[model samples]
Target: MSARRILQLGNPLLRAVSTPSSDSGECERILTDLRDTLHEFQRTRGFGRGISAVQIGEPKRLLYLEFRGRPYTLVNPEWDWRSEETFRLWDDCFSFPDLLVYVERSCAVRVRYQDLCGASHVLEAENDLSELLQHEMDHLDGILTIDRAIDRNSFCTREEWLRQGHPATRPEAFASKT
Candidate 1:
């Protein structure tokens, strides 16, 4: 029930794929730590929607998110479906809070996951929620936003991005997933 240190980029642990958690008690503890860490980040950094267990040096497939005033806990989540339509955005991560990476993600996605009680549930999301889930799920697979950069110029510091007038303009034609 305490905030844990977030692993930064270049940490080999961040590159290791997370494993599924088999113990409900362990999963619950990880979820609590994630929630605390996310809240701390929001309080100090001013912005953070979701966090994965791997970000806290725990290689477990767990994620905690707070979106639109609602909290979500996902364990062993897997994508059920992804829309062909995609959108580009300046994505940031708690692991690398000071950097913004331009990446593309599905406009809609359906994810299946287990809750704290070990019950399975499905979530259908679009727009912002869809993008957020995709981003966090990537962490479970050891994929960071930087790994999905659109190009060599797809990265910039948070300060530079703000200086550029927050150029998060949507692309006209949606790019196909590669």
Candidate 2:
């Protein structure tokens, strides 16, 4: 498997809504590629939470996420529930290469998705995990954390992002799947 080239911020694919897989067969291939892509991202970037197929030029509703310690593979994922509390956090995107956007997201969430084995799994995540799921799922919806920022000018380059302090706020509500 090859390390798929991550689509940068200006790529139209990052702005377009992804289509769901045509069938389970297609989803299986997406899962494998996504897993490979995730491995590649981890190896090259040293960190990542999840990725959507669209971010790699595949306009399918597929995502692979690792929440803190638990790795989850989601196919045709969707948000089934969300929490009332919201928190703000600094978020970065692989597609954007290296830019930081402070955005608000749910503090807790409930999601439903299909695993590689074709079984369904319901996951509940909070804090960083919840933030991650919301972020990847936004890819499917043609949305990015950058869109949520009230001050777009606050966006920072990778170098500045690293030097910046930790996220100082959180969104009031959070829910996500995938």
Model 2, 121-150: lDDT tens digits are: 898888888888899999998898788874
Evaluated at residue 9, the lDDT of candidate 1 is 94
TM-score of 1: 0.94
Give candidate 2 regions above 4 Å deviation.
165-178
Give the worst 10-residue stretch by lDDT in candidate 2: 169-178
lDDT of 2 at 126: 87
The local distance difference test score of each candidate is: 0.92, 0.79
User: Taking the tens digit of each residue's C-alpha lDDT, what string does model 1 give over 1-178?
Assistant: 8999999999999998999997999999999999999999999999999999999999999999999999999999999999999988999998888898888899999999999788999999999999999999999999999999997667789898788687785233532332
* Whole-structure CA lDDT of model 1: 0.92
